[model samples]
Target: MTSTRRRGLIDIEIDAQKEKVRKIKEDNRIFDTLETDKTTLDNEKKKWFFTRWFSPTSIDDLEKRIARKEQKIKEGLERTSIDKIHELEERIRILELAKTNRCENVVWMDVPEILDKKIQDDYLEKFRKLPQKIDEQVQSVNITMFGGVGVGKSSFLNTVVTALINNPQRIYRDYKTAPSTTGISKTKAFIPEEIRKKRGQSYREHPTFKDVMHCIVFVIPATTNLYDRDDEALNKIRNLQQRINGPRDVKQVAIVTNIDRIGVPNVDMESVFKYPNVKEFCEDVSKVLEIEIQSVYPIANYHEEQKPTAAKNALALMALWDMFKCGERHIKKKLEIGLNDDQ
Candidate 1:
């Protein structure tokens, strides 16, 4: 067989896999909607005695509808196994890796150069004033990033600090701390299990929002293969996620870094979202980390560039904005819970 023919066959398989994944996602959405409607109907039926007496037939019809929806949901669940999706996705990944530039632009993000400065200034301004607006009990917001070694964790923090400063010449030498003025404090590096365990114990006992992480960011490289990294590292990350976000109610986001390493022709930092593989990579990370796709942000750090470009800065700043919002929401939730308890 000719090489060209084999390549053509692989391309067809990749397309088929992608289509299968899409259909499964659509089916899952329908199942979710059906489940939601069924729950609402069930609640309506359980409401007041007036509802049942005045409209017995209506209630009976609603119950019948709920039963049908439940059956449909059960059928959908049987058909759509999470393991099946993972298998198909793995096949797609293998096929994609076999060919260069196998994926096209599957997603889009508006990144006009004219709007770059506006986005930068808007987020920067918000960060500048956020410290003042935050509740005094919270003191300051902390964002802790957890990932394997060399996943661009420090580089991402550096890029964010540089972009928030909006200065090309201004150098941020320290990777450990983001400036206090930014109203954000980033952990120096990946925390060891012992240190994290100590902190976890302290948090459980004290239960104070102060000096605790409000936002947890998981940095995963786009080029990282699931099988390549150490299993211990990956397991540690998952354990951390369950421990921190599970009990603490801290908002979580996954930052997919090193997107430029992905096979995209003439790819720029701003154009990361334009590549199908980048989006897939984000999806892969999301599935691996159990994070929502929307919460996953893909970015290229300032590695080679001597100075930051607006596109790069804008991308970094966009992720920062998300992290900021997540942190703020965590703080507000704690305050609201405290207020409710007081009442």
Candidate 2:
């Protein structure tokens, strides 16, 4: 489409999207108010609020209204449209072209925002740490995988490890091994703490893992309604987080895995962007999870990559980049410095 035509389309889409989002926000507020009122009702019924006398007619009317209102709100959330998000995405992509014109203003970062140069530099010496390689010194980040069970958490983590290691076979073999479950399980994934004891000539040392632990990876499956998260949604993820009792401010990213199974008929690892809904899925998931849109990613893991494909590697790497950006944003907040677009 011509730039002029695209501009007109974007403006219209933006207005539509804005109105839809406004309604979603209003619905959420209404639900919150209803929930609060219901809690108060419960307390009164239990006589915990020093109310021994209660009117049955008034109680029945209030309970009925609250139940009806709650259902309405639930339906609204499930039906929240992503048309606005897609429109905004198109707008942003078009605007970004201005910055990347002739590649003069394009911005990029080589290292994860949360990593120190000295620590990431260990990748040069440590090569890659193994499940039992307690003697290798390396930087580690704790990734708490959150999603409904079997959302490809273990598969994605294994993909990342394979990409970064000098010996992919070793990582693959370890992933097959039962103990490698330590890297990623239904509950949590981590760089095992079985200390790296030596280096080429000097003893290996791990200095960064302890300080920046608990990076959160929120996973959304392609099989579910991306926004209509009635029983299955970010609230469940948040509850899990509270139960784990990790730091309230741990850096977080959302990974929409199993992209190969999204509504598209020709779903594959390489054709992510061709499916426009995939982009919409990422943005909607981000909003529901309450994180930056840029922090949301849709990726295919190594489930089908017997030897690891380039497409899978690239997808996994970008996912890692965003996770680091989440960590970086937390760091920026610490220093009281604002974040940039590249992050």
Candidate 3:
């Protein structure tokens, strides 16, 4: 099975287990309360008082309730159904198979030749024209990149703008990146200061298609261990996704940066997908972000490179192409749904 599909199945299982645990804990709390009540009734019955003899019926009723709760807990404990057993067997088989076989490439693409200007131009043109072709209310596609402090969100944005403009000499205002000393993000708002200044209005106040972000791109480091990720930061990411994208029904994608750092098959950018580590990283990010595995794009940014290459440009443009498409779809769908609601 493909890493993407396997990751999706694993995510579903994780969510199901969490829900089951929650339900069991809730039931346990109720069971504990019933047990406490039964104990109180038993103690009352043990007292050598007139009330003890009168409350025999209450004690019996409490015992009956406790027995029922105990039975329910027993049933809940035996939750290993046939489907779960089969899923466990399948997971074991996949793991055993992976021990000998290499991971298959999840994403396939033809690397644009360095001399193929026409194809490169087409990519840039398609991305540039998407906003204009979208709904009239959306004059520009606003894409928000958010994630952990120094996961290369700013660098990825710089790479996209650089590739889109196809200019290295042009001094465009860049997003403030993390400093080497303390890896802190200065991007406090969704829209950067430059764009906000140009628009002279805040997206929060406007809440319009033109002002709001249409697509959310979550950036993650290729080396990040999601298991060890900070709980606070992860919660913030989930809340940010829910508050912005979930409510607006905006499309979301994830970018795994620093692909070069993860040992990409002899340091070749073209072999990114062929690298098992890269696919594994993408799968991890997809599961954590609750996005489709296909929506996770892994790429190396032009962090230290002076000029862009065809390979780098192709990766950047591919991600941009998806982002533009996502933004356009969001605009169209939002407008259609709004119209329907009004009618």
Q: Using TM-score as the measure, which candidate wins?
A: 1
Q: On residues 181-224, what C-alpha lDDT tens digit does candidate 2 reach at each position?
A: 23433335422222243354422353343343346787778666
Residue 263's lDDT in candidate 2: 45
Q: Global lDDT of each model? A: 0.68, 0.54, 0.62
**Error at 232, model 1, angstroms:** 2.6
Look at candidate 3 and tell me the lDDT of residue 226: 76
Looking at model 2, residue 259 earns an lDDT score of 69
What is candidate 3's lDDT per residue for 1-343, written digit by digit as tens?
Answer: 6455333222444456556655655665765587687777667677626544565676678778778777776776433454765665565444333332333534434433231345557787765554333556666567777776777776776666566667645422373432322212233324333444565443254454566667888777777767765665566667777665435677888888887666542124543555577777788877888888878888778765656655566677788788768887777787776732211
Per-residue CA lDDT of model 1 for 1-343, tens digit only, reads 6455332444566788899899897777766677677776666667646455455676677677767757766775544888899998987876566455443435544433222456667767766665465787876668888888888887887777788777776645454565666544546555655563675433443445666678888888777775546676677787787676544677889888777667632223433454677778788877888777878887767765666666667777778788878888888888886732211
Give candidate 2 misplaced runs (Cα > 4 Å).
1-140, 166-214, 227-233, 240-247, 263-268, 328-343
**Candidate 3 — which residues are off by over 4 angstroms?**
1-122, 128-133, 167-203, 229-231, 245-247, 265-267, 339-343
Candidates ranked by TM-score: 1, 3, 2
**CA displacement after TM-score superposition, residue 146 of candidate 2 (Å):** 1.5
Tell me, by lDDT, which candidate is best. Answer: 1
Candidate 1 Cα deviation (angstroms), residue 126: 2.9
